[model samples]
Target: MNKKIRFSDINMMNDYQEERWGYRVFELAVTNILNDELLQKKFPSLNEAFFQKVDEIIAPLQLLLYPVISCFSKDPDVLSQWRAYADDGRGFALGFNGVALNSMPVTLLEVEYDQKIQIEEMKTALLAAHIRNLESGNDFGSQFRTDCQLIGAWKVGFKNSAFREEKEVRSLHMLDVCVDGDRPRLVDAGGEALGKEVNGEQVGYRVQDGAIIAYVDIPIPHLDNAPLIQEVWVGPKNINGIGNIVYFMSECGLKDYAIHQSKASYR
Candidate 1:
């Protein structure tokens, strides 16, 4: 007979899944917000406000993203635990985790304010709403309170993610950018510098929109073994010639490059 795999056993195998699970929780909250009829009726502009709040909240919440991802990725056993709770059709298992449900009332307050559009008026409205819900003593009202608390916790996770921590020194490369029919330039920490006459310079080249451009090679010592190259583009198109640069970084073992910024294009 085959033995059932315990949640603990799965968790030990892959721990990063916990973070992913947290994201799932966040998604559930979003769904609830979208589906809440009373919430929608109370705040006719709920959709816009909800999304706007989500954007404002995401940066702070990002701190939790990686940890939750890591938790689930590092442990497969945790999934079993989550699945056991979600065995019912709902895909969410509500347990009394004792997470405070009313600590951060900003989102709720915002919802109330949005309805009244007046500070003092909204405060009175929210107080009345809270009292009315409490007085009902119904399961629906209780669940509504629970959902609000869960959303608050999710926000806390996001705020926590925004806090900075010490990061390990990693190798990074610099790519000099040059434009056609103009002087060559290199970019570094200080800024862009025009190229002077130099012998035995190994220039790197990349094709952009079918035009081959030249780059001066500065072998970054720390990043010598680093496979990624961070390219800073200088243009004959501009006075400084350093218009846009691309930074190539690694995330989750995948090589990716981003166009950091760009200048206004002529023509």
Candidate 2:
């Protein structure tokens, strides 16, 4: 009932197929840029300094900024989703307004499950950098930060092809690991740090599945003080009926929101 959205650390995700794939994708992109004969021929000016600078940008991206993920899906009432994600059809799927939800300070991306598309996106970003360098000449450093940010978000959105049916949309936010306990810390390009966070969103911890999970709560904003939730679908195996669920929703401060029981016959 805190009226906040929780984005948990990607490290806590149970999807082993996608774990550490972000860093792997970035590394593969770097290797392709350096050794791919076609790309090497196209961007001959990409010297050691360019890669060194990229390495500098990636270090902090890998270590300092922890990727936090909040996942949503377009489908609200799929049987597989209910069986796999909803405690075997005993939970609920929250439906949120896409426009209002994405207005928050995070990169919202559609999850790509095709391996070929994932590889191409990484390669395309590298080629885009080459083009920018050609236009800007020696000023490529100006775009490195933005490039890293794109890579950070892009790298995390690729999932295994098996998950394509989920049609997941993920909100990815990078949290600085160096931030002071309860106080925000900023690290400069030269590695200097120590500063207060302007927004004051604090990190929290919870124990899940025998492991400690770290997350940050983003305060949900109400539009004209209206409820942000659009609807919720109760799972098929949920023991509680709609009446009790409606009462729970009221206690959670939601009003006039539509609630539906899962149509799946799965028990």
Candidate 3:
């Protein structure tokens, strides 16, 4: 009766610009800092060598655990969302309970698309990483690595302004691969197959557009006396009727949820 939710790789997302914009912002911030004479004079510790070191640490994290994300749109019935994501009005849009979503052990945050804000955030993370590196006396760069992981995960949440209209709130989690002898295993945030297993499979991978995409199925707990799912919006081109939807929901043991028809006139 418990359903598992899948979070896909940010890089393998439908949007080609996913996470690329954030990296560009990071690059731009570092470039500006390195070029500015007054800034370099003020913070002599943050030189090219320091930036390169930070990049070296961060690059592996980015490659190894490129933050898998589950995105939820604030507007459930937008025309563009339906067309771009939902098989051009043929699929259904599920509305989840925000309160229930927040209750789960996940990193749920709103996506930032503003270039100016992203640049500032990138700069701040870089400065913090540098400070952490300087303070780590015995453990070496361990604290910096931990800080970079958080910052790297944060970078995945930064999308381009073009996707700003989606008004997305994303659940971010990292997927790390550890090679043990012959086989490679996927590790999640908490290391328990990224939380839990689904149907004896902790993680699942499928080929999409000739590329293998990895996803983890996290169990969605049924809230006590509350519905985890709020509603289901039938897409514009969907031919299913009210009776069919009601029957499906009933058979699935889903209760206290409404079904609405999308108002979009797309054929």
lDDT of each: 0.29, 0.73, 0.77
What's model 1's TM-score?
0.22
Clashing pairs in 3: none
Preferred candidate (TM-score higher): 1 or 2: 2
Model 1 alpha-carbon miss at residue 201, Å: 46
Q: What range of 10 consecutive residues in model 1 has the weakest lDDT sum?
A: 1-10
Model 3: per-residue Cα lDDT over 187-250, one tens digit each? 6654323344323236678899899998876766567887877899999999898888888888
Cα distance off (Å), candidate 1, residue 48: 3.8
Candidate 2, residues 168-239, lDDT tens digits: the string is 999876666574677654332111112222353676789988998888877655566556788988899988
- Candidate number with greatest lDDT: 3
Task: Using TM-score, rank the candidates from best to worst.
Answer: 3, 2, 1
Any runs in candidate 2 off by more than 4 Å, and if so which?
A: 17-19, 29-38, 46-52, 179-198, 225-227
Q: Point out where model 1 deviates above 4 Å.
A: 1-13, 63-267
- lDDT against true structure, model 3: 0.77
Ranking by lDDT: 3, 2, 1
TM-score of 2: 0.82
Question: Whose TM-score is greatest here?
Answer: 3
